[model samples]
Target: MAWNEPGGNNNDPWKNRGGRDQGPPDLDEVFKNILNKFGKFGGGKGGSSDGKGFGLGISLVVGLLVIVWFISGFYTIREAERGVVLRFGEFSHFVEPGLRWKPTFIDSVLPVDVQTVRSLPSSGSMLTEDENVVRVEMEVQYRILEPYKYSFSVTSPETSLSQAFDSAIRYVVGHSKMDDVLTSGREVARQNVREELQAILEPYDMGISIVDMNFKDARPPEEVKAAFDDAIAAQEDEQRFINEAEAYSREIEPRARGQVNRMAEEAQAYKEQSILKAQGEIARFEELLPQYQAAPKVTRSRIYLETLESVYANTSKILVDTKGSGNMLYLPLDKILERQNTSNAPSTNRRTLEGLRNQDPAAENGPQDTGIRSDRLRSGRN
Candidate 1:
């Protein structure tokens, strides 16, 4: 019967002897007997309990090994790590950063760095769609997003990513023009390559997310590098010239517009002034119209004299065709006026006043006689 079965081995070996009840072996006696057996086995081949002592030593050794195995199972994961656990060489679960324990010799943990960014470089001279070759260098930054996939999904995630990088870049370069690969279209090419790379990598799902992709440098091949450099320099110069021209336009356009506005204002002011002057002249003529109607001959003579006076004031010479003269007379009126002006000098005027007071009244018409003589001489010249 089993030991715990009722009415069976109570049969308890400690209490039963030869099917009769004997008090349990005394504790003191049992211990003493074990010690004596140990002492005899250690001293010499003098006891029959040697095999039992050997068995006890084996049990103690097995227990110590078991305790060591349990203790070694305890492990600590660093803050920047993720633990990928595998049970019996197959994926099980992931563990976070902290102290953790697992069944000894039954599971394994692979720590992967998830927080750090990794860089991969790609560079080569590749052909473009326009049958041109360009040397390109690029850098790709990535981080692990799924540790399980990083460790178990692929044999080599980095290598796969590198291949994908090459494929994406070559595809983009092959479809783009050489100018795009090497010059102003660089940013556009970079964006296209990144998008293509992401598309290519999507199916693989290697548990890596691209942090950034930089187009480090792009240049022409060695055989034509100098020529390409010249072309690039020319393009830069063209852009610079265009920018300077635009700046000049921006600066000059406002001044031109302002000049137009100023000219327009001046013309408007001139128009208003001319209009007002014409209106004033018309009003003055209207006031004279009734007088001319009442006395045509006197009004006509007065108007002619006033017109002559206005014309003479602005002129230095006059022309006169005498009533029956066959030729024109040119009068040097400016010279006569100059002589008359000199006669008003301080000393000359004072002398003339004294002379006039002592002289006869017949000489009072001296200036008039001289003016008439001047007129006669002007007519004789004609």
Candidate 2:
């Protein structure tokens, strides 16, 4: 069952043809046998042909390795990216976005995204100008403008930019009041931080352009939040009140102007009416003057009589003549006016006039000649 048993044929599994005990095969002889097989390909018996065949095999291996290295050097850049070439671990040049190649070991390419916007946010509780602490959060958006500077100008551009942002934000916060940082002054503080950050990064040339800076949030500490909210509310109310007042002023001003215009128009109309009335009066007097010049006595008598008739029509008192005897009748005007005002009846006034006309004058006064001028009045009329 077992080979090399004592009573067995003493057979070796490795085929020991010498029938002698051997430890193991020698590595030198095995390699020589392999070389002999390869030497047969040269189809020669001398050592010179074997050496040439070995050299050819070594050259083929080297060529394959060189081709692999050359192919590995070729890379592609994306549409939004640029490649920064480094030669022997130093900055060489920049490459545009496309398929490109370089010496495998002699040059390297570092692709940097140039078209993407990067954001950096910085937030912390900072001391304000009034010695109050306020938590401020801000974000800076930037883009790589120069790939070379972004890659090699500093050890780490992003770290340096972050530090610059911190420094600028702190400086701005330190110079601003707490109320302003928390409220109406956030925009001003944001602008100042952006300007100061740009200034700080100017010397380093980090190849970053600040597209925008936003004041994300600003607030007081938790302990004083309620109080600040109240203050802000009061400020808002004050603004609302001011706006309302302005709106009311705008609404009322037009109405007041309209009223003033209407009053002015009314006054103008009254003035025009008075001027027209005066002109008409002047025209009437001018016409009357000519008539008076034509016949002075007749016009004078007619004017006197017209004046008397107008006066008598307005008065309640009347003068009556007794045709049979030289007697004058006196009518009580006060009693008649009192009766007329109390009754306001035309019949009462007529009855009073008729009773006075039919009264017996002889019984009341016996022949009282009251300077009778009836004949002169009649003569003037004629």
In order of listing, the candidates' clash counts read: 0, 0
Q: Estimate each model's TM-score.
A: 0.56, 0.61
Residue by residue across 1-382, what tens digits does model 2's lDDT show? Answer: 6786788675676675577556577999887766665565545365333776666655666899999999998899999999999999999988998999999989989999999999999999999999999998999999999988898899989899999999999999999999888878888999999999999999998888999999999989999999999999998899999999999999999999999999999999999999999999899879878988997665665555444445544666555555545565566765566655654544454554446435533212211311234443344334
Residue 271 of model 1: what lDDT? 100
Q: In candidate 1, which residue ranges exceed 4 Å CA deviation?
A: 1-51, 252-382
Model 2 misplaced stretches (Cα beyond 4 Å): 1-49, 254-382
- Quality of model 1 by C-alpha lDDT: 0.79
Candidate 1 weakest lDDT stretch, 10 residues = 360-369
Q: How far is 94's C-alpha from truth in model 2 (Å)?
A: 2.1
